[model samples]
Target: MKIKFRVILSISIIAVTTLMFVSCASDPDSSGLEYMPDMYRSPAIEPYVDYGEVRGRENKDLKLKRSAMIPPSGTIPYYGTDSATVALMMPYARKANVAMKSTHGMYDAVLTKENEYDFALADKNPLKLTSDNMGDLFDTGKKLFTANCAHCHGAKGNGNGPMVVSGAYVGVPDYANLTNLSDGQIFYSIYYGKGMMGAHNSLLDKREIWTLVHYIRKFQDTDYGTSQSAKALEAN
Candidate 1:
């Protein structure tokens, strides 16, 4: 009776081991049979995931559909409850020209038949420059410019940035020569892009663009935004 029991126990162990190896052999990529597959793999949907073919089952309806989508028009992202900040963060009033669809690839932007660039000339900088804020504003502007514009616009705003120096780009106008451009025009150009420059609206917020406008002004006039300049502006 003892010998027979030993033989039965050895056969049971061999059978269990063979079954484990056979399960793994079914799929080269998969390990042996999974006890709880969902524990390791999440069922939650993610953006940009192709849901057309899931678990070896193909769904024709979802084949070409993208998970990511553009936001609805006039949708304002939350900017907290600060009235002043919210106002400053509001969407720009000027619409891109229809030509911008072809010229700047702004296909989704609200397009207009009118020349909004000309309209922007009359728009004034909403960010007021005071004697107290000039220093901090310029400091922030310099940092923003360095990170975003310096590569193509130059460290000194002379259109001699590294890209121009390397002979990779041209036609970048110097800020010193653009003294005739109004603050709004400068802001618009930077926001929507001008000539070889691409639109910076995605990279910079409205306030930051306005701040850059102030900093660009300093390039044209060394004493810009200073107490003396403030007095000069007030007198004018």
Candidate 2:
């Protein structure tokens, strides 16, 4: 009788100890026992979010279903009302060299038998600047630069952007050193990426890229395009 009583007592002690440990270790009001609390919650619908489960509950039918797709080739986007802007947005006449197929994955692009990137040196920036619109253009340029270039090219165009400072990427050249690059060549490099950089044509439209060219030129020549705008405003 004493042995059975001792066994029951031992079992009760173990149960009490377990309950106490659990209660002390976790807060019932909080995300109880979750090592990574974010793993248990869905804050928003992300393109890459795995919606298979939420907080230990599994039900695909309850989650938002997303389908991935790419736009078809040769489909032109609406370039808006400006005739000059529309002309500027037309397809680039220059072609990438045959080596681009293996080097830069220009498989989908029309490749050339010879090197044509060199020809881009003759190209000029079509987006002329004047004092009347220079201020607004730089304002637009600043927003575009922050959104696209600042992360990799640094806020000051010194090539020490956060990605470089954090060691996530390397070998980003300073804009000041690239003074010899023609405006058109700069456009080409961004449209069809050069070296390690990927093509940005899909991400940025042609008009936006030209605006960036004007902004980038400011790095090489601090007073670039400003005088033109100032002169135009004064003349007007």
Backbone clashes for every candidate come to 0, 2
TM-score of each: 0.74, 0.64
Instruction: For residues 1-236, write the lDDT of model 1, one tens digit per residue.
Output: 99999999999999999977776746667655656656644567767877786655688998868967767878899999999889888999998888888888787889999989999988888888877787898999999999999988899999899999999999988899998888889988988887678898989999999999989988988877666675338413
Pick the lDDT winner: 1
As for model 2, its CA RMSD to the true structure in angstroms is 10.3
lDDT of 2 by residue, 89-167 (tens): 8877788878777877788888888667788888877777766777887888888999998989999999999999999
Candidate 2 TM-score to native:
0.64
Against the true structure, candidate 1 reaches a TM-score of 0.74
For candidate 1, the clash count comes to: 0
- Where model 1 places Cα greater than 4 Å from the true spot, the runs are 1-42, 48-66, 131-133, 230-236
Model 1 CA lDDT for position 124 = 83
User: Candidate 1: lDDT of 80?
Assistant: 98
